[model samples]
Target: MKPQTRFNRRDFLQTATAATAAGVFIGTSSASHAQDSPNERPVFATIGLRNQGWTITDKSTKFADFAAFADVDANVLGMINEKLEKKTGKKAEGYKDYREVLDRKDIDAVMIAAPDHWHTKISVEAMLAGKDVYCEKPLTLTIDEGKLIEKIVKQTGRVFQVGTMQRTENQHRFLKAIALIREGRIGEIRKVTCGINGATGSPVIPAIDPPEGLDWDMWLGPAPKVPYRAGTEMRRGYGGGVPLHTNCHYAWRNWYETSGGQMNDWGAHHVDIATWALDASETGPNKVTPVSYSLPVEYKDGYPTVSDQYNSPTKFEIHVNMPGDIPMIITSEGDNGILFEGTKGRFFVNRGRLAGKPIEDLETNPLPEDAVEKVYGGAVSENHTANFIEGMRSREQPISDVWTHNRMLETCHLANIAIRLGRELNWDPTKREIIGDDEANSFLSRESRKGYEINM
Candidate 1:
């Protein structure tokens, strides 16, 4: 059924921030809401229940109830269904097709952990179906997809949260880091380095028949159909024993067709923090240069020339000319964290720790008492899902709004484009296009395979 559309997203966002500033008593406690009589917790269904999907669902159980789960892999679907029941004591229905989950009126929101190619498609349709969305990042496969999502979100008036959990989660370390920057502990901002690490290059994996009970076609939605490739190489200690070299499972990270490799995988997390700290969320860089990079396979015209091998960059260092002339480097070499170099002092932060001279000086020259809360807009939630639920109840957008996410994501996408083209790109952020480069501009959007177009 087509969901009724409202144009209240502007007011939705307005209420969350305005009510907070007015001291309306929302979020005074971790679970508190604005209403005197609160609504029931939002009912959630998760799509693409692979590794990250279940992880999000597990963390979100405190704020939302699970009604359904959808995935293309039947074995994984069954396994996760049992796990969810054990964890939440709810027997959520499982489906091989995600559309069934979106069609359900009982579900209030969806947590999308689909492969990168499917993020935009599933997210747009879920919003159109009257369901709020918490999609995994990097949210879109291309820049045009991001714009399309922003439009649909405003049109539907639904609360949307990207799974850039670092904004709200990560043990409050990232929040503290951003707060230190806000407090001017690091005087004048200079250069920032996002050491998001690199992608795992793959050896040639032999094409194999589709694994039993896996809907391969559904898994490849919007991406070009290709052979399912796997090898005897085992990727242990992560993702619960999925083959290490398989194109269909965790190794999908190494494929440009299914994901952006490390550029967007970790890049989405760290680059987002860098952009937020630089105060460049609403705008973007004017230049993106492929300073140094290495791809595992040959490419022609920005498309990989081979199959059965990972084509995304194995090593990369992207140099971006950010707004205000700040030089931001997204690179593979270094400790996995964001390093901020400023005129006064510097700090390094990631999920694990927040460190540096500025961080150390907090003992004597402390920031305002509400520093972290101010940076986070209010008291932090127990988790990102708590923030999303708060947004749902407040009729507001979550901390990771579409506009800011897309702005930072443009850097990652452009970096991927520049590396694939082996050149630099001049961007006009106001126009949201490549400057005087028609060929590069074409990379901003991709043609989805027929019959898998996004449902508006």
Candidate 2:
């Protein structure tokens, strides 16, 4: 068979989709990557075997074989390997350090779901180790980290996929939203509101000893070392059964040391879609202002004055001045979704629904059958993981490229910076820096702890 390189965009999509459906082997030579001949599936391994880690691996099982699993928690690492064996009847190796998974030449690709702090380190190492990567978003802890990942990706020529699945999944609702904008169903976009939920202030909990079979220090990785704290209340959903206010696991999102709280958490998803719909994926906002916000902890020189409780903002309404004079509003209040207001019409979209007068008018003045496909740039993959697999086969970037992700994520990262500094920031997007605030510019990159620094 031909290398699939000769096919044009439409033809390429058909070939890849049909070949995937038929379960045929293709892509980089078998010698180049681990491959199972009988089933013609790629070899896979997973890092950070918690909630999302297991989810992406389990979903990828349809097209790949789990060769290894790694996590800082021995309990989680061992348990996930066991679950894979039970579910797929395939025995797999488990390790505490992700380096072990990257060390294996047999693994063609690795799916990273580590906490935000560990993302860049592991991803850079994995790519340098010659592995294609499907990593969860917000892919970096700071703006500098995102730039580093982008540089490594181009330098290595490795396929990379950011897990902003809304670009591919969500029942094609997001894609349709972007398509509507492209189709002129909504005239000219005037404003966009991304209603990502706000962070919650955690109550100060006394420090406690780390959990059994957990390597506390290794888990802290690139972030500052801090005492493990847990409240009496345990969470009960998605990432449930863990302490509701710990420095790890479910509660990692609450602290700026490890993650960017709500602004970087849900903001990565919704703001990403909003950016795509506005056709501003390559360019970022000119300014990020804290219209109004409340941080749970006090700040002294942009550092948290108190350490016991959550420091990220509990409520925020940030105003971003984007290109084309569009006001992209990111609010913690309102329905958790995106509202696109344009000159011709407006529509609201989230995981559950896509509704508006424009959507209703589609009944009479229908969009083209290939609206979503055009928005996706070709035939859409059945899911985000599928898109990653297709990227691996074609040696092309996936739907959510790191470059575009970082460009839009700058707004979210800057919003956090504005709230932390208690002032609006003038940004020079071309230079990718805070225009005049030296203190705010300091937040653009973080110094990784000595031992946890990225190998790159």
CA-lDDT, candidates in order: 0.84, 0.85
The Cα error of candidate 2 at residue 383, in Å, is 0.8
Tens-digit lDDT string for candidate 2 (1-456) = 111111222343464456546865334222226323433678888899899999998888988888898899998887888889889998689889889888788888999999999999999898888788999999988998988887777656567889999988889999899889989988999999999997778778789999899999999988888888888888898898788888888788889999999999999999998887777776789988899999998899889998788888899999999889899999999999999999999999999999999999999998899888877878989889888877777656788888778988899999999999899999997788999789999999999988988876
Candidate 2 global CA lDDT score: 0.85
- Please provide, for model 1 over 70-160, each residue's C-alpha lDDT reduced to its tens digit, 9 standing for 90 to 100: 9999898999999988997878998888899887877888999989999999998888787788999999999999999988776666678
Compute the lDDT of residue 169 as modeled in candidate 1. Answer: 85
Residue ranges of candidate 1 with Cα displaced over 4 Å? 1-37
Pairs in clash, predicted candidate 1: none
The alpha-carbon root-mean-square deviation between model 2 and the true structure, to one decimal in Å, is 5.3
Sliding window of 10 residues with minimal summed lDDT for model 2: 1-10
